[model samples]
Target: MHDMQKELSTDELMGRFLNQLKDEDQLTEKQKRIMEAAVKLFSEKGFHAASTSEIAKEAGVAEGTIFRHFKTKKDILISLVAPIMLRFASPLLLKDVRKLMGSDLPLDDLLKQLYQNRLQIIEKNWSQIRLIIQEMQFHEELRGAVVENLFGVGRKLAEAFVSSKIQSGEIRNFPPLTVTRALVSMMVGYVFFKFVIFPDEGMNLDDEQEIEIMVDIILNGIRNKE
Candidate 1:
């Protein structure tokens, strides 16, 4: 087949797949309306307490539309993950980190910028984050995809950064992977605890303060004392 023909074929396949997903019995216009309503209802009421009829009414769709799109109402709840991940992953992957850490930016400034960026991302996606945490116990595949797509990229990027810093003699001589995991664990744990575990009294620390504390703790252990 000609290259152009192959490309056209691939495009057609993708279009068909997308259309199928959109037009799924449970995902038609009415179903989408219901799903949107369900998401809001679920967020406010919790998934277990939210009902299909309530979602349908809120969406201005019949209760049957909800069932048509998703065999069970729980499926609508699960579907939110895909859209959330799709919206968030691009920025996380493609944002210009190098520009943020340019030569003019001091280490403290760079760290502060990075932390604030991460914090903003987490805050924006807090709903999806909550959904994943709540459902992971029942859905191993969802948990795996979340780890693979989200944390996996983070770990790779962090490992590369740590390796470069160590090579430049700006950081300590710990194993790159180990240091990356430790740093990520520290940052992720702080975010998870502050936003998810204790949102009522979220960490009120300013970006600079949080970055300073993290940098001080990490640098103290990693910097060559010589």
Candidate 2:
């Protein structure tokens, strides 16, 4: 929304997104405090091991105050997940994606934009995302809920986007799903390698510049030349 993709760090974007949503939701100061506390503790300690009292202590609120906003600890987890879904996993944001697929934009340009947008989202919510991923391994119901509510429609939209690119001869001919996976891997893999595997803080390249290189490699490797 701010067009500060290359300028802002992931933490800044996350703080901005959090503040924006808090204002929209009209969450009380105490509620914000509790939510922040829950994020910290849940990420540090497993949710099963983190108690309401510990979260309350971290937030500097009475334990009962958390119940004022959330019915249970699980509800707290859902609240943390909502911002991610609204930003990246929602179908409303698919309009821009659909336009990109249908437009005459260069594949490199479209993919560079897509990669930056995704990295911004992932970086902004890495903590909550990591927590959710960890918990989903043990919680079938939580995984099912995420799949049904977010991934189901999101996957279809992604497939449709990939199909559009294929029909236009922009990329190689392959199964839409395979194309989706390849594109996604390039995007996600860069983040994993750059931030997690290598942790290069001294890199001078911004997200757009780095992702453009990745897009070039992908296109050069995959383009169908008749």
Candidate 3:
């Protein structure tokens, strides 16, 4: 079976693969400091622009200490990939969807809860998300992982929900994939427009208002029903 097809829990896989070093005392304090510094610097500056010396300075370690932990500056960039996948993508792909699906709340209420949960997650991990988005352009591995683990899982979940709703005649009959894409696109566009494109102006709607407006728009098209 393919690695992707394996049923290993993300936490278990991560612990087995990543924590081994930490458990064996192979990961030193200096390495931990370097990783933290690298995450911050790489998030703020693109990988091409970030420097080992700058990372070392931020970590309060000698420049050579970086090489002791990482073979090259590029290794530091690569290191960000696993953590980004484990910390950010894994929760959305593996955990949040399960909780959302199991909830007894109504669809609209559930969506609001899920939206808030996602928003909080994004706000807390904004730097890491920014780093992944920035680095994805240059790294094929990062791009593939985002496509396979993040967007792919999300698309699948959305399709499942849309299909169920359509089967029950709760929603208009449309291609499940198309509906999923449209819904996801709308939410992503709203987030990008608010945070990335017009951040200086601030969010136009508060959380509750935003949820209400978004839910209304999604459930009912822009066309007047009358």
Evaluation by lDDT, superior candidate among 1 and 3:
3
TM-score of predicted structure 3 = 0.78
Q: Evaluate residue 65 in candidate 3 and report its C-alpha lDDT on the 0 to 100 scale.
A: 82
TM-score of each: 0.69, 0.79, 0.78
Give the candidates in order of lDDT, highest first.
Answer: 2, 3, 1
Better of 1 and 2 by lDDT: 2
Instruction: Give me the runs in candidate 2 sitting further than 4 Å from their true place.
Output: 1-25, 200-205, 222-226
Candidate 2 accuracy as TM-score: 0.79
What are the per-residue Cα lDDT tens digits for candidate 2 across 1-226?
Answer: 1111243343443344344454326877888888889889988897888898999999998988887787677667667766765666556766666666567778788888777767777787788777877777765656665676567766787788888778878767899999888887887677677656776751444777777778887878646577
Against the true structure, what is every candidate's RMSD?
Answer: 8.6, 9.9, 6.6
Worst 10 residues of 2 by lDDT: 1-10
Identify the superior model by lDDT, candidate 2 or candidate 3.
Answer: 2
Ranked by TM-score, the better of candidates 1 and 3 is 3
Q: lDDT tens digits, residues 60-149, model 1?
A: 978776666666664565466665544445444436654574446666567667777777777887766676677656555556666666
Against the reference, the lDDT scores of all candidates come to: 0.64, 0.72, 0.70
lDDT of 3 at 175: 94
Ranking by TM-score: 2, 3, 1
| Model 1 global lDDT (CA atoms, 0 to 1) | 0.64
> Which regions in candidate 3 have their CA more than 4 angstroms from the true location?
1-29, 88-93, 203-205, 224-226
